[model samples]
Target: MTSLKNVQSKSSKSCYVIFCCCTFIFAPLLIGSIIYQSSGIKIPTILSSINATFSVENLIDSPTKIIATIPHIPLESFICDKINISRFPVSSTTQTNDSFDVYRKNVLEKYCDIVPVPRYNWSSPKSYTENDIAFVIFTAAAFFHTRTTAARDTWVSRITNYYFLSATPYPYLPITVVPGAGEDKLSNMKKLFYGLQIIYKQQMNLSPDKQQKWFYIAGCDTFILPHHLLKRLHGLDYRQPIRVGGHWGQHDCPGPNGTKFQAEFPSGGAGFFFSMKLLEILQPHLTNYVENVWPRNSEISDVALSCLSHQLGVPLTKQVGFWAHPPAFTLGENGRDKFHKEPEPNDFHYIKPDEMHALDEFYIYQHMDRLINDRNWSEFTQFMRRFVASHYELLRKKRRECTLPTIEAEVKLSNK
Candidate 1:
């Protein structure tokens, strides 16, 4: 009876030992397999070293480190891939005003990917006088009171000769605004034609030796670096009827069945340069040209001018440094309002009214001097690149924070 009792005790002990060994060996594998199946993440086979470096709690709290451990994965792609959001539907109702607003918002959101930042190679400041170039500035009567004022207070003073091209009277600049045919695209073209007429008349009135070599046209919002522009112009022959400006590649026209057209015109925002010879060639045909190419409401003045250049068989030279979009520094409200307002020894002083019009004007007022005087163009370029990168980073962070909610709301609205 004693021997049988001892055998039963030994058998029970052996069973207990087997159960302990199985739990110790198989529990971790089971847990890891469950995690892998659910989350599509492979659990590391060896955890002892990993645990020594990063605690499980720390890894849970900071998933960014875990994401970093993954190779060649962008944070945006990771987050966006993880979140399942429905796309906003496009229907016939998308043509409505409210839907158009949403469409425009969507388009603007994609600008970071579409539009490229402008870059220019720096040249040594050349010895060219103000008399070498004349400026024709385009503005509307609506914007004249504000945009025109901002322009005059800034870079306009740096040049000797500049004419305001508008239908309205601007006596503050003391130059009569040249009247266009009317305020429409065709009218704006006529205004430019009229401006050319005026410049031609002035040139005809002057002695041949005293005539200017280059004619420049810019919008009120454009910031001109006179020294840099003059340096660029100096390299080209004033004797030839050359057209110089930034060029855009093939882009779709603004219509439902928009066809792509190759545009080699300078961006009007960055401004364009016409040699005196080219202006002279254009003078004789200005009236007829304006009458024939009567601007369609959808036609852009710059593109039209480029087309005209092609028709005239003039060469279009692509130069850099012209910016179509405002710089990153002049993005926010504070940057637009009070940038470079602090008085400096050599700075141009102007009383910026309580009401301001364009941010580009303020940006020019702030950085014109620095850009003109940049002895180290490479350094300036690097600084600008860094500034733009930082701006985009912050913008990306903001977009990421709000993307989920915005997308969800849009999805709900679409469903309704």
Candidate 2:
């Protein structure tokens, strides 16, 4: 009996030790998980802490580590990609007198006169050297075959990692048709929030190298100078929270103090650029806190986005590049709103299809004229973005008195 008692005592002590070790090892993780789950705000990762604490130098090897080699679910396995909460609260001001069917019908009917873009070869690429950038092309299905087509043909065609979130799916376009994203035409707040959410989920991981660090979000009508934009992002760390756009000092966005005076953000049409870390911090709040407190009153998508970033502690950082309006020779001031009174536009917003094609030429030939004629690549402006520019413009000068987006051109182009 004494011998049995001794053995049982030893067993009890061994069990106690094992239990303590487990608590020490997993207690923090459990606590952190609980906090994240409950608040849906701060997510604690163990990749080094959540991803394995890798060095910046180490990211060079796998710069796209966000998409795990083995995803939680297979990419092709997706039949539907709805968020946790599919619709806004019925009491919210986003509710409309017109049902979604009516809204979508109006959208389609409005753009029905436009021709559908030819299907792109999804398997191959447009041959430009891929960069660590992911594009969020916020589009409506109405513009899918027109404006988006123009963009895809020019610069977007060259980049393979672009995303299109449409109100309804275009069977031919490689896009995700989100449910509530477009139902409320009151504002583009839902669309913008879901867009970033989708992007964040697509590359959620601890591996910094496996994720595209820089994200650019713009409307389908916006024209992008990817090569020029890349220069802007050079040497910027992906881990830092960076937001760059037209620093329109507007205080109409939502604030942490339940007001719109907290944040000043960039123009949505011209587009905005952000780093990965800022996105990660904002990911959790998109579905929960954001939707709940979004403006029922006067809310602009760009303002709301900027305000949210400010609330999350990120401020707008701008440099010389954005063209808030479409390109006009006399539009920008040298050291003021743009680089040099020149239309050295990094992103041109509120443009039409013809202007997109024309602007493509305007930028392309200016470089070709320089390279073949002057042969000077200095100040980094010479190449035609040669490989990226359209072959149709190679022999022609489409920039001279061509169709522009100055209100009238869009009307004329639409009639044709």
Candidate 3:
């Protein structure tokens, strides 16, 4: 009886040991699985901080890093091959009205009748070289002010409608006028193509040389030309294959504060060169932006591109100019109430027709026998001649210095 009781006790001990071993082996796995499930639950990434920390450089250089770091968001995409850019000069003050439209139409008719050949020794380039270029003009209401106001001597035209046409005239010239549309109509990103298509039709008129090197010029109050523009952004060799319009300055553009006033760049109105490219890209998406969806009121299309850049992870090659003090406007003092004329040691202050001395005026009259009706063209050509005559040596020297990248190299890099 004692032996049987001892054996029962041993059997009970064996069962207890087996249970202990099982608990030790399985406990870690159960706890580990609970911890693993908790870890699998994700916390969303904060974006505004990422935007502030990462810069335009990171976006340009290594976009993937930023893509991984930021939260995923839906982006509107359109296949765009061209970019529409517009230029507004800072001097003119003509508003859009019926009478002004008539005047502009007349200018266009006259411009189309003439050929924009190599007008000046320097105004026309020999060939649209390795870095080919084009211009897209945005005619705002102000450029319609054709008269020579004050001694500023802005907007003079010379119409020789009879004595032109050595070659087939570029059809959209004398003046290429863009019909005005309300900003509300333009704000839709999808429908921007209609305006682009219209521009493309006009550009078809340029000479093959001018066509290859197409550049758009607008009749607005705050335009920046391509020469100064390319210099300001990247070294002239940089591929400005893409750009878009946004806010710029305040003199002609009426706004409390805009990209124009910001001191540091990557802000400011899209200048003339950009308009050409914008037209090219937005045409495909124009129907979408303009027709279906409405444009955002505060967000100008040009400014919207910057936001788009962030969304797409595409880096802007250069930052637009921003203003801190009074803006750098082309129109002389009389054009603006806020304008101040400080001593500009760097500028070549050319003498206007009125500024000339009696002897100088007499000489000009003797030399200027050619008859041209448009004061804007006459004065501008005269200024160009004077500028060239005074600084031709300097300009020629600078031309030699303006080195551009080879097209083959650029193409190779782009492919990579």
Candidate 4:
């Protein structure tokens, strides 16, 4: 019985030794895993490498540094909330293209339901007239002739005053030379500033009676529907210092030391309107703002102007029709063919160009007159719904057929 007691004691001591060894081996690992999960960092590997030197403070601080270096997601509120449509439906069971098409169709239907229809009488001659608004188009010399000529032939006649503003000389067109600014993106910002200066100087020189009521700045590639634009502007009090455009937000600007700054600005593609009064107010401070206050190396003209607008207390009003992206109906083979038709001379064009090459005088006006004059609001909406769905499907198909293969080839080459 005494020998049995001795054996039991030895067995108990062996069990205690195993328990102590297991705790020593796993306690640190368990703690490290908890820390990793909480901090969203790989703490186990780090702890293993620096087990002797690791401390609680180091584990906590490392994640904070990583978080600081990451770029922030842009705020949705900075831009207009009109196009924040519901996400396209997707399911694990379905193919990506099919799911995207379904989503696109759904969104097109929603857009058609809400697009505003013109209430003014189309048959009445008094419904439309040339206004005192001026179009200050920022053009490059390369496409200046083609783009400006297209504008003149298409929509320029609907407005009273318009000029193609460019750095290079276009002796044929009534071009306003904004010297010292180049044709690059950074130069575009400078060009806008200088153009504003010129406009201000002209205003200063003009008799009070002859001063323009509003100034519209747009890219050379932009196609604007003068009648629709005028109708929209007529609703606003131009005498007040107000600005309006297709508002964009949630853009991140890089700052010093791996930081990002959020920005909200109007898209230059859709065009932006500034009341004469607003321009007058901005004119005095334009030089100082551009020279001193504007952020360096910022190439986007819209963003620069937006920053200045923020500082000057001019709020940007968002218009639904002001499209920043290329319109849905203007993509793929059908869209290209559609834009190649000639529009009627008398009717107001509702389509605007988002790119230089999109200006097709022959096709852009195709069925536009009917859409503008013959179709009722409901009919117009339905037409647009069909147009959007068809165009987007072609776009998706093209991307899948052309773009995906190119991307795959690039990936393979990189892998090699």
Q: Which candidate is the best by lDDT?
A: 2
Q: What tens digits encode model 4's per-residue C-alpha lDDT throughout 168-248?
A: 876555578888888776777777888888877887798887777778888765667664565546467667887877635
In candidate 2, what are the lDDT values of residues 31-99, reduced to their tens digit? 765765675433122222222221222212222212112111111101011122223344455667454
Which of the two, 1 or 4, has more TM-score?
4
lDDT of 1 by residue, 218-257 (tens): 7776656565566556568888889877624433322113
Better of 1 and 2 by lDDT: 2
- TM-score, predicted candidate 4 vs. hidden true structure: 0.50
Q: Model 3: runs farther than 4 Å from truth?
A: 1-143, 146-193, 204-208, 212-219, 223-227, 233-240, 244-272, 275-279, 294-299, 305-314, 319-325, 328-416
Provide the lDDT at 11 for model 1. 57
Local distance difference test, each candidate? 0.54, 0.59, 0.31, 0.55
Model 3 worst lDDT window (10 residues): 157-166
Cα-based RMSD of candidate 4: 23.9
How far off is residue 60 in model 3, in Å? Answer: 61
Model 4 C-alpha lDDT versus the unseen true structure: 0.55
User: 48-72, model 3: which lDDT tens digit per residue?
Assistant: 2122132222212222211212322
Candidate 2: which stretches are off by over 4 Å? 1-130, 205-208, 256-260, 297-299, 329-343, 371-416
| lDDT: worst 10-residue window of model 1 | 65-74
